[model samples]
Target chain A: MSADVLSAYPASQLAIREVGLRDGLQMTARWPSTPKKLEWVDREAAAGVRYFEVGSFLPADKVPRFADVREVIAGVSRHPGAHGIALALNQRGATDALATGVQEITLVISASEAHNAANVRRTQEQSLAEIANVVRLRDEAGSATIINAGIAMAFGCSLSGAVPEDAVLRMIDRCLEAGVDMVGVADTVGYAGPRQVASLCRRIADRLGPLPYVLHLHDTRGTGIANAAAALDAGCRILDASLAGLGGCPFAPGATGNVVIEDLVFLAETMGFSTGIDLGKLVALRDIPAGEMPGEALFGALAKAGPPRAMSWQAARP
Target chain B: MSADVLSAYPASQLAIREVGLRDGLQMTARWPSTPKKLEWVDREAAAGVRYFEVGSFLPADKVPRFADVREVIAGVSRHPGAHGIALALNQRGATDALATGVQEITLVISASEAHNAANVRRTQEQSLAEIANVVRLRDEAGSATIINAGIAMAFGCSLSGAVPEDAVLRMIDRCLEAGVDMVGVADTVGYAGPRQVASLCRRIADRLGPLPYVLHLHDTRGTGIANAAAALDAGCRILDASLAGLGGCPFAPGATGNVVIEDLVFLAETMGFSTGIDLGKLVALRDIPAGEMPGEALFGALAKAGPPRAMSWQAARP
Candidate 1:
C-alpha cells in the first residue's frame, strides 16, 4: 500500500499532549505528592509521550493541588526531548510560569463574554490585553518559550449558551496579533458535537492557512473522542487530553474530565495515525492514578478492556 | 438556507432503533417486571421512538427475564405506529416470533467463525442456512414482518479477532440472496474505530447501492458514539442503541452496553437532524429503569449534564 493509503493523517504530524498532572488533578478529591507526579512524568516520557501539561500557575491557597508547579516543571525539564506545558490565567501567573522556564505557558481567554467575566473576573478584551502583556514579557526576557493562547468556551458556554463562530475567530485573530506561538480551541464544558468540531476546525484552517492550533476537549456529554476524530479529519495534528479522563469545569455543571489520553491514543493509532506513545505502556500508567487517588473514579474504556488483540493491523501496513 | 444546508443527512432519512428492552435488559443485575417493561415501551413510544426491539424469542429456561417476551410484544403492539422487533437465534425462535405478528424480527450470525460457533453453537454457514430457513418460514406464513439479519462481530471479533471487510461483505451478500428485507453490521466487541466504520460503510454502499443497513455498535472502548457519527457521514442512516447504555456480551470481556440512545439522540438533534424524539422525555425515561433495577448502573452523559442552553441552533438554520 502507498503511504497515503496507510493513513489519512500522516503519523509524523500527529501529537497527543498529556494533561493529566495539570488538568486531571485540578478537580481531583486528592492530589498526588510531588514525587508521584514526577514519577508519572518520567514513566510517561519513557513510554514515548513527548508533550505534557505538568501543572498550572495559580494561587496556592485556591488550588493547592497545583502548588508544587515549579517542582513538577523542574522534574519534567530533566527529561530530554520532553516538553512541559503549564497554564496561567493572568500576567502574574504567566510571569511566575516564565520564571520556571517551562517549555510552554498557556493563557486562556473564553470566547463567551459571560464566561470570560465569570471565570477570570475580566472582559474578553481585558483577557486579550493580559495575553498581550504576557507575550511582551516572554519576548523581553529573550526566552525561547512557546506561548499558546487557548480560547475557552470556544464551541459553546454553560453561562452564555452558544458561542458564535465569528466571536471565536475574532479571539484567534487577536491571539495571533499578540504574537503567541500557537492558539487552541477548547470545548470547556464538552458542549461540542463532532459536526460542530469539524465545522470549527475547518473554519480555523481556512482563516489562517498553515498556522498551528490544538483542540482541548472535555467528555462531559460523551462527544469528546468523536470530536477528536473530527479534528483529525479536519487536519488538526495536536490534541489535549487527560490521563484516566480526569478534570472538570466548576462553571459547567455536571462536567466531566478531558478526553482520556489512553483512548485518544488508541483511536489515533488504530485509525493508522501513529501517536508515538505505546498503547500498552500508556494504558498501564492508569494504575498510577488509580493507586494514588484511591477513591477517585478514574475513567477509560481501553484501560478496562485492554488493547484489542489485532492491534498489529497498523504495523502490517506496507 | 436550503434544506440540504440544514443537515448533511436529511432528517427524514435518519432512524434510531431502540434495543434497550432486548439488548439492555439481557444482562441487567435485575430485570424490570412485565408491567415496568410495558411502561418503558409506552413512555419511549410516546416520546416519538417508532422502532423498538422489544425482546428475543428464546427458551424461557435459558433467559427467564425474557420469558414474558410475548406479553411485552402484546403490550407494545397496542401503540399505533409503534413498531416492535424481536430477536430469533434459530428456526424455532423465528417461528414463535412470527406467530406474535411483531413488526420486525432480527436474526444474528457472527462473521467470525469462532464467535459464531461460541455464541450460537453453529458455524457461520450453518447460521446463514438457518437465516434462510427463517426467511422461508416468514414467506410461507405470508407475514408482513420485516426480517433483519444482523451480522454480529461484523467489524471485529473478540474470539477470533480482525474480521476482514470482504468477510462481512460476503455475509451481507448471502443475506441479500436469502431475501432478507434489511441487514445490519455490528461492532460486537467495540473494536471498530471511526475510520474503519467510514471505510466499511462506503464499501457497503458501493457494493449494494441504496440498500438500507443499520450499525449495531457497543461502547466497550468509548468509540461507539464516534463510530455512529462516521456511519452517518458514510450515509448509513439507521443506528441501534440502548437506553442508559444497558447491554453487554458475555463473549466480549469487559463489554459495556450499546451506545446510549439518549446521547445518540442528542448527537443527532444537535447536528441538525430531526430525530422526532423528545430529548427531555427520553432522558426522563431513564428513571424507570433505574427505579426498577436498583443498583444496576445506568450510563449516559446527556442525562447527567442536561441539554445545552442553546439547542435551537438547528431550528434557527435558514
Candidate 2:
C-alpha cells in the first residue's frame, strides 16, 4: 500500500500586525498606558515582528480604550524603522492618521449588512462611501501611509448568520475602486471555519493578484490559530494578532480571543516559516498579567504549557 | 508562482471527547449538576459527537467536583450507541470505571519525571505499577473498557523544561509492558507547538505501532487545537477535548483551556473529514450554557459565529 504522503506547506514568511494596541484594547474596558504600548512596540520590533496596528483614531468617547492614539503613533514612529499602523474608520480618522506620521493606515468596513448597521450605525454602502473618501484623502495628503481597506465581518456577521461571498466580493471591489493600496479579510466574529476561510481568502487573492494581504482573525470559536494557519496556506502574509490573544467582537456574541500572537508565532516558526519572531521572547511577553480585563480572557497554549523542550523553532532548524 | 492551489481538507469524520464533565471539572473548584453534565452529554451526543470522558473516579472527598461520576456514566451510557470514556488514576478509580460499564478506561502517566511525581504523587515506575494493576483489574472484571495509558508531558514539562523523546518512548514501552490496549500522548502543560507536536507524535506512533493512539491536548499555550489537528495528520485517531474549551493545569502556572471539542469537530468537518457530527445541532447546544458552572470559561466558534455557507463541508463534496 502506497503511503499517502502529504507535502508540507512551502516555507513561508509572515508579518504580524500587532493589533493589541488598537483593536484589542478598544474592545476592553481597561486600556493600557500609551507608554506601555509604545514600550511593547520597541520590544516587539526587537523580537522581529514588523507591521503594528498601533492605534485607531476613532472618537475617543466611542472607545476610551484607544484614548492615546496620537501618543502611541508618535512613540512607535520614533523607532528608526517600524511599520506602525493606525485604524481610520472615516476620513476624519484618516486625516488624524496622516498627521501622526505612521507608515501604514488601515480603513475598516463591515461586510455583514446587519453588523455594519448595528456596529457602526451605518449601512454597507455608507461604510464603502467613507472608505472611498478615506482613500482619496490619503492620496491628497501625499503621505506614504499605505491604506489597506480591511473588511470586518467578511466571513460571518454577529448579527447575521450568512455572509455571502458575493457581498464580500462587492466590498473588495469597492476598496479597489476607492483606490486603496491593498485589502484585508477578517473573520470578525470568529465564525469562519477553515474551509470558508480558505475559499473566501482564495477568492479575494485571486481577484487582487499578488499584492500582499492581511488576515484579522478572532479565536472566539477556538479556531483562530487554525484559521490563521489555513490563511497562510492560502497565501496570506500579514497576520493581525493581539498579544496574549487579547481581542473580541463587542457585537459578536461570545466573540472573544484574537489569534494569540505568541502561539501563532510559535506555530509558524516551528513549521520552518521565517516569522522573524523569537518564540522564547514571545512566550515571555504573554507571561505579563493583565488584571480585571473582564470578559476579555487571555487565550493561548504554548505559553501555559511551556515550550516543548525550550525548543525555539529556529534553534532546531539553523 | 504556479497559481498556488488551495486544497481543501475533507470534512473530518472526527471524534471529539467532551471532557468538561470529566477532565475540566475534575481539576477545578466546582463541578456542576449531574443534570447539567448529563444535559451536556445528551446535547453533545445529539450534536453528533460520539464519545465523552464522562468523569473521573477518585474518592469524592479527594475530588468532590466529580462525586457525580456514577450518575454521569449512567446518564451518558443511556444514549443508545455513544462512547463513554472515564479516567482512572488508580485501582479504585478503575474499579468504579469497570462497575460503570464504560466503553474505555484511560490511565495517566507524565513522561516528565517531575510532572509524574506532582500529578499522582508517584515515581514513573510506581505509576507504571499502578497502571499494570489497573490493566489486570479490567481484565478480571470481564469489562470491555479499552485501556489507554496516556503519557502526558511528552513534549516538554513546565517544571522539567525539556522532556526527551526517548523518555516518552520508554513510557510507551512501560504501557505496552502493562498489557494495556492502547497508549496515547499528551502535552500536559501545553508546551507543544505544531512541529513539536507532529514530530513527537510521529516518533511515538512509530514506536507504539498504532494502538488506537490518542492525543490529549490543552490550549493553555494556545496551540492546542492546531497541535491536535497536526497529530491527526501524523496519524492519531483518538483525540481528547473538552466542551467550551474548559480544563487547565492546576499545578502549572497560567495554563488553562482545553482543545475545545466543538471547535475541533468544526475544524475536522471544514477541513473535509467526516466527523459524523451535526454542526447545526452543535451550535444549538450552546444554549445549555456550560459556562455557568463557575470559574470555567467555555468556548467554541460555530456556536458563536454562525457557520460559513460553504461550512456544510460534508454536503459540499457530494
Candidate 3:
C-alpha cells in the first residue's frame, strides 16, 4: 500500500528553476554579500538545484544589490552541473550579461502596456525592439547562452487591468521571431487563477509545439502553487520559484514573492514529479537568508510544518 | 474581451461552505459570544454564503466553546436561505443536534485507525456502529436532517501515516450503507497534494456516481487552495473552508486551520465558478474574527492583497 498517488503526466520531465538568489534578493532591504550569494548557489546546487537565476544585469547604481552579478555568475559557472541565468531588461544589460558568458539571460516585456511602461518606463513596442536587439547582440557574439524572454503580467496586470490573451500570444510570437531560445509566461502580479494559467499554458503549448516555456508565478494572492500545478497539468515542465518565497514586483503594488521553491518541490514530488532536488537540504538553505536579511519576511509552509509523516519520495517517484 | 477565463465544468453548481465557527474556533484560545457568532452568520449570509457549519454538538463541559451550539443553530435557521450544519461525534450529540431541528448534522469517522482511537477513543468499527445508531435514531424521530459522514484523514494521517485508498473507500461504503445522505473527505493533517486529492476524489466519484461529496481541506502545508482547485477539476462541487483560515487538529500536531474561505471564494470566483459569494463583503468578514480573537493568528492572501483591480463579478460569471 504505497502512500503516494502518482501524477498522470511525466514526472521525470518536471524542472524547478531557482530564482531566489536574483529575484528573491531584488526586493530585499539588504542583500547577502557576494560570498554569501555564492554559498547560497553552491548549497542549493549541492542539493540538486541545477538552474539558478543568479542576478540581474541592471546598472550597479540603479540596483546596487546586483552589483556583483558577474562575480555571482562566475561562481555559479564553477559548478559544471548548474546553469546560471541572469535577467537583462535592456540591450546594455544583455550585452553586459553576454560579456560575463552567463549560461542564460532572460529579458522581460510586459503584456499590459501600462505595466510595461510603469516597470521599465518603455512601451511594449520598445521592449520588443530591445528584445530583438539583444538577440542580434547574442548572435553576433556567437554566445551559446540561452536567450529567454518573459512576458510579465501575462495573466492580468495590476496597473492595466485585463491583459488580453491575444496581446500575450502576439508578444510570444514576436519574441520567438526575435530568435529567443525560450519564453516564459509570468503572472507578475499574482493575479492568475489555476484555470487562467492552464488555459494560457495550453494555448502556448498548442502554439509552440516543442518550444520550451517557463511559468513564472507570484504567490501574492495565494494562487501561486495552484497555478503551478495547473501549469504542470497543461504540460508545463519548467517553473520559476524563489527560495522561501522571497521577491516581489516593484510595479505590482502589494505583491509578494515568487512561489516558494521548497514548497513547490514538495508539491512536485508529492504530485509524482521528480524535481531531483532534496527537500530537507533545500529547506535548510532558508537559514542563510534569514541570518543575513534579518526582519525580512520569510514565507513557506513546509518550513513551519515538516513534510507529511507518510511522505516517501521513493513511493512518489515514477 | 472578457478578462475572466471560465472553468470547463459547471460554474453555477459550485458551493463554498463556511466552517469557521465550528472547525475554526475548535482550537482557538478564545471564541466570540453567541451573539457575535450569530452576527457573523448573518453578515456572511448577507454576502450570499448559504451554507455554514455552525458548531459541534458535543458536551459543553468538555468543549466549552460550543456550549451555545443550539443558540447558534437557531440563529442560523432564522435566515431563510441559510442552512446550518453541526458536527455530531456520537449518538448523544446527533440526537441533540436533531432535536434542535438543524438542517444538517455531520458524523466523522477517521480512515486512519490510530487517528480514530486518538481523537475519539474509539475504534473505526465503533465509530461506524455509532453512525448506524445515529441514523436509526434520526429515522425514529422522523427528522429531515441530512446526515453527512466525513472520512477524516482520507488523504493521509499524522498518527497512522498513510491512509490507504482502499480503507477510505471501504469506510465510505460502510457510511453510505449506514444511511448517510452525503459524505465528506477531510485532509485532517494537510497531508495531501493536488494530485492525491484529484486521484482520491476521482475514485470516490467513480464509485458513487452523482453522489454529492465535500472536500474539507487544511492549509497546513500551503497546498490547501491547490488541492481545492484540483477537487473542483475532479468534479467536486461543495468545499469546506474556514474564515481567515482559522482552526487546527488537536490530534494532528502542527496542523494549521482549514483553507481560507475568502481565498477559496476568490479562487472559485476567479476560476469562473459562480459561488454567488460577494468577494468584497466576504473579505471584510475577516475583521470580525481578527477583532474578537485579538492575538490569534488569521490567514489569507486576498485579505492582504486586494482583489485584482480588474476582478469583475459580471465578467467572471458565466
Top candidate on DockQ is 1
Residues B1-318 of candidate 1 have per-residue lDDT tens digits of 001111222346687989999988887778889999999999999998877888889999989999999999998888887778899989999999999988788999888889888899998888888988988998899887788889998888777767889888998999878778778899888888999999899998898675667799988888888888888888888899999888875655555679999889888876767889998999999888889999877777778777776776433211
In model 2, how large is the Cα lDDT of residue B99? 89
On residues A1-318, what C-alpha lDDT tens digit does candidate 1 reach at each position? 011111222245677889989888877789788889989988899898888898888899988999999999998889987778899988899999988988888998988889889888999888888988998998888876788888998888878677778878988999988778778999988888888889889999898676667899988888888889889999888899988888866655445678989889888876888777888888888878888998776777777677787776333211
Question: Residue-pair clashes per candidate, as listed?
Answer: 0, 30, 0
> How close is chain B to the truth by TM-score, in each candidate?
0.93, 0.89, 0.93
Q: Could you give the interface RMSD of candidate 1 in angstroms? A: 3.1
Judged by lDDT against the true structure, how good is candidate 2? 0.72
What's the true lDDT of residue A286 in model 2?
53
- Stretches off by above 4 angstroms in model 1 are A1-11, A252-254, A313-318, B1-11, B313-318
Q: Report lDDT (Cα) of residue A136, candidate 3.
A: 87
RMSD values, in order shown:
5.2, 8.4, 6.2
DockQ of 3: 0.38
Candidate 3 overall Cα lDDT vs. reference?
Answer: 0.83
In model 2, the Cα lDDT at residue A271 comes to 61
Give the DockQ of candidate 2.
Answer: 0.32
